[model samples]
Target: MSPSMPDTPTPPLALSPPDLRPWRDGGSGVDHVHVRDSGRPGPTVMLQALTHGNELCGAIALDWLLRQQVRPLRGRLVLAFANMAAFERFDPNSPYASRCVDEDLNRVWDDAVLHGPRDSVELRRARALRPFIDAADVLLDLHSMQEAGAPPLAICGMTDKSLPLARALGQPATMLVDTGHAAGLRLIDRGGFADSASPRQALLIECGAHWEAISAELAIDVSLRFLRHLGVVDADWAESHLRCPLPERQRLLRVGEGIAARSQAFRFVMPTHHLMVIPRAGTLLAEDDGHRFFTPHDDCVLVMPSRRAGEAGQTMVRLGRYED
Candidate 1:
C-alpha cells in the first residue's frame, strides 16, 4: 500500500461529466469514433478526448462540437472519446480513481505493447482504436493536469513536425518536447506520428486542471483552432465560437529528464507546479527513501509534479529547459 502524504483538499468539480451515450454508436464502425468526410482530397484529421477518464475538459469540448454540428470541409474529421469504461466510473467525489480501469490507455500505444498477448480493459480498447488512429493523417489528443493553477501545455514528441503543429494551434503558451514516459509510449507517439520524416503529426494538449470549468473552455478553443488550422472547419466558424484571445506567442520547453520516485518515501522539498523554473543548479527538489535529488542545471523547469507522494517508481516530475 502507498504511504499517506499530506491531505490536500480536492478542488470543487466545476464541470459536469459529459453524457457520452449519443456517441457510443459512432458511424465509423467503432464505438466513439465520429467520422465526417467532405469527399474532397485532404489530410484526415482526428481529435481525441478522454485519453485519461478523469480529464473531463476534452470530453466537454467534444460534446460541444457534436452539439454545434461541426463538420469537415475537406478530407475527413474524426472526433473520438476514448477510455469509455474508465470514464463511466467517474465520480465527482473520487474523480482521480477513474483515471483508468485496468491500465492507462495513453501508455499502451507501442507496437510491442499493442501486439503483445497481454490483455487489459485499456489495451483491448487501444487495439480496437488502433486502426482509426493508423488511418489518421493528423491527431490532436486532449488531456488535463493534476495540479491546480498549472498553465495549459502542448506536449509534443521530440520532432520538428509536431512542434509546428503545436505552434499552429496557438492557444497554449508552453509547448513541451518529450520522448514520453519510460514505462510506455503515448498515443501521440505511435507509428508515423513519432517519425520526424513522416508527414503525419500529432499533438497532445494539457488544457488545465482536471475538473476546472476554464479547462473545458480552453479545450474548445484549442480544438476549434486545430480544426481551423487543418481546414476541417472554416476560420469564421471556429473564430466565432472562440471565447478568448490567442496567446501572443508560445514558448518551447525541451524536457531533459523525468524525476522518478526512487522509493515509497518520495517527497518534494516544496510544492511545485508545471513550468516552475528552479534558478540554480543543485537545488534540492526532493528526497526519496535515503536519496536526495537536486537540479542538474540552472534554470531547470519542473513539469507536472505528482500529487501522489511515495508512489514507487512513478514519475514525480519532469525537469526541462527553455528552448530559444
Candidate 2:
C-alpha cells in the first residue's frame, strides 16, 4: 500500500467488490472484455473500468451494466474490465494492496512501452486491450480518488474534442483540462483519443473516494449518461438508471502545472481539499526536498492533492485555474 498520513486511519470498505468471475471469459476473445454490436453502423463506444483494482466504483458500475444486459442501440458497445488480475487479489482488509501487481495499468499506454520488449502484467494487458481501444470512437474510463469527499471530476485530456464532450455530459460539474502525467501516457490520452483531428475522444472520470458507496452510484450514473450521450443506449433506459441530478452547469479548470514530489519527505503545509481555490498568488502550499511550492497566480485551484507521502517524481498535486 502507498504511504498515507500516519494520523489518518484506513477508511471502512463501504462497497463490496463485485464478483467478476463470470466476466472472465468475455465475448471479445480477450479476458474480461465484452463487446455488443448492433450491426447497424455507428461509432463504437467503450466503457472501461478497474484500471486500478483499488478503485472499485468503476468495476461495480461495469458489472451492474453487464448484469442489466445493456446493449448498443446503434453501433458497438465495449465493456472492458481491466487489471482483473490485480482486482482478483483484492481483499477488503487491505484494499490498497491490489491497485496493480507490477505497475499502474493506467501508465503503460505509450506506444513505446506497449511495443517495447519490457514485459509486465499491466503491459501485457494494455497490449491485449489496444485493438479495442483503437477501434473506439468514444471511451469513458471510470476511476475514483484516494481522498474522501472530493467532488467528481472529468479529466478531459489536452484535446479540443474532450472539453466539449465533458460539457455535454453536464453532471460531474467540474472538468479539468490536463496533459497526461509525466510518468507515462494515460489510457484516455492514447492514440486517436488525444488527436485533435481525430473524431475519437476519451474521458477519465474521478468518481469520488475509492470505497465510498456514493462513488459507485456516481460511476453508474456517469456511465448511463455517457452511453445516452453517445446514442448507444436508449435514452429512457439510461435516464431511468441515472440517480444523480444534472449540475446547473459545468465549469472548466485548466491545469497549469502538476507538482511532482522530489523526495519521500514531500508534504503540504496543511491539509488541502480538491478544487480548493486560494485567492492570493504566492501562497505556501507544499515543500519537497529543499524546494517549496506556492500558488503561481491568484484564484489558483488545487486539484487532486495527494494525502499520501509521495514517492520521488510522483504527482503530489496539480495547480489549475477556472476557465468559466
Candidate 3:
C-alpha cells in the first residue's frame, strides 16, 4: 500500500510548509515555482528534484514543504521540481515510472550540453535552470537507488570540495568515487566531484528505492537537515534527520560486465531497488541454461546490478565498519 494509503491516518496535511500549484508555469512545462523568502538575501540553498522525471518521491516532500511554514533561520530556501513533461505523464501508483523523456536529466550538468541548440527536452530543462545552480550557496540534489538492499548512502564522487559535506550528512560509510563534477555524466559527478565550490557545494543522497514511501519522507528529512547544516533551520530538526551512519572506510565492488550481461541471464534482480549481496567467492547470479556463472571474489555489498536482469556485478557496494 502507498504511504498515502487511506488507512494510515494521513497525518493531517499541515499548511506549515510552502505551497506550489498549477504546477505549470505558463505551459512552459515548468512545474510549480515555489519561493519562500527568495529575495530575503541570505546564502541561497537549492534543492532540485524529479530531474529524472520518474523519481517523484521528492514531489511528495515538495508538496509537504509547500503546505508547511518553512522559516529558514538563515539563508534563502529554493525548491524546484523538474520534468513537467513526465509530471504531466504520470499515472497513479506509478510515480517513478519515466526516467526521462529522451535522456537522463541528472546526467546533464554541463553548461555546453545544456545550452547547446541540439539539446533534448531534458537538456533544455537543465539549461533553463543553470543560473540558479551557479549562484546557490549549496545544492542538495535528492535521489533514490533502484535496488532493495543497498543502504541509503551519500555519493562524494571524489570531489575534494564535496567530501567534507558528504561526511557531514552522517551516512557513516562514504565512498570516494572518481568522476568529474562539471561534465554532468551523472547528476552529481563532474569536475572530480571534488571541486572547491566556494560559497557553494552539492551532495547527492540516495533516500530509498523507487515508489518507496520512506523515500519521499527521507528526502524531506535530509532537506531539513541541510537547512540546519546551512544554519538556515533549527538544530533540533537536523538532529532528528541524522541517521546512524555506517563506517568511515568502504569498498566499492566493481561491475565488470555492466547492464548488458544482466539483461540476458540474471533473473529477478532489481538494480534501481538496491538489493542482493554477493558474498566473496560465492554465487552472485547463476546464468540460465547453466552456461555461465557469476561470483564475487571479495565480500561486498552488491550495489546496482550492472546487467539489466543479471544478478551479478553492478551496484555492488560493500561498506566497512572500520577505517582502513
Q: Rank candidates by lDDT, best first.
A: 2, 1, 3
Please give the TM-score that candidate 2 achieves against the real structure: 0.96
lDDT of 2 by residue, 1-324 (tens): 133334456688899989998888778899999999999989999999999977899999999999998888999999999998899998877777888889988888989999999999999999999999999999999999877787899999876579888888887999988866777899999988888889899999999888998899999999998999989999999988889888888998888668887888999998799899999999998887789988899999988887655468777788899989
TM-score of each: 0.96, 0.96, 0.70
lDDT of 1 at 79: 89
Which candidate has the highest lDDT of all? 2
Cα distance off (Å), candidate 1, residue 49: 0.5
- Badly placed stretches (over 4 Å) of model 3 are 1-31, 35-42, 93-96, 148-150, 171-184, 190-199, 237-297, 306-324
What would you estimate as the lDDT of candidate 2?
0.87
Candidate 3 per-residue lDDT, tens place, 47-69, comes to: 77776555556766666665555
Give candidate 3's whole-model lDDT. 0.54
lDDT of 2 at 239: 88
